[model samples]
Target: MIQSIQYSLDVIQDEARQLVQKGVVSRQQPIYVLCNYIPAREWGWVESELEKSDFLLRDRIGDLISHENWEND
Candidate 1:
């Protein structure tokens, strides 16, 4: 489950950064704006899991929220 969340976050961040780099959006914008572009099917479970335990997730990831591949990166 954690792996799935990490994967979704990675893709979301990558696409978000690309959009920012292209001037399509600003880095200061909320990430939820770019989330619509991500596949809902793949992210649905992750979103549910996050909602179920938002605090636990935050504790698990800590300050690595913006880091890609939390296990290795």
Candidate 2:
């Protein structure tokens, strides 16, 4: 059986960063798009965390992530 992983704000950010690294998602994309990338079973947890963190579906992925190398030079 697959163990369920909890999706906290930190985990969401980490996963977003990796997605950015993998070019699967860009920081400018809407947060809603993440549902397409994340497994359906876990997306609910992630979405809830985002909502609690004051994030909207239309919010940019960058809003969830912190300052990193992606910053404009």
Candidate 3:
């Protein structure tokens, strides 16, 4: 579970940096501009901005499942 969250955070940060670099997001503003107000969900969206990006998220999740995944499952 910890691993999953860590990977997701990593991908989100990577994507956020990319967005800032591309001018899609402003450095002075919060990441919520490109993503929703919710950091995790918005970060997840960032992970899926492109095709096969979903796989990027899934790869990070690995075999660790969490309460959130269970409730949604």
Query: Pairs clashing in candidate 1?
Result: none
Question: In terms of TM-score, which candidate is strongest?
Answer: 2
Provide the global lDDT of candidate 1 against the true structure. 0.49
lDDT of 3 by residue, 1-73 (tens): 3333433545555655666667665655633454442366345545544223333332322211111222454
Clashing pairs in 2: none
Per-residue lDDT of model 2, residues 2-71, tens digit only: 8777798888888888998899999999888888878999988998888887889899988778733345
User: Model 2, which residues run further than 4 Å from truth?
Assistant: 67-73
- Residue-pair clashes per prediction, in order, are 0, 0, 0
Candidate 3: stretches off by over 4 Å:
1-7, 36-73
On a 0 to 1 TM-score scale, where does candidate 2 land against the true structure?
0.80
Q: Superposing all C-alpha atoms, what RMSD in Å does each candidate have to the true structure?
A: 7.7, 5.7, 13.1
Q: lDDT of all predictions, in order shown?
A: 0.49, 0.84, 0.43
Better of 1 and 2 by TM-score: 2
Q: Which ten residues in a row have the lowest lDDT in candidate 3?
A: 60-69
Please report the candidate that would top lDDT against the real structure. 2
What is the TM-score of each predicted model, taking all chains together? 0.44, 0.80, 0.38
**Model 3, residue pairs in steric clash:** none
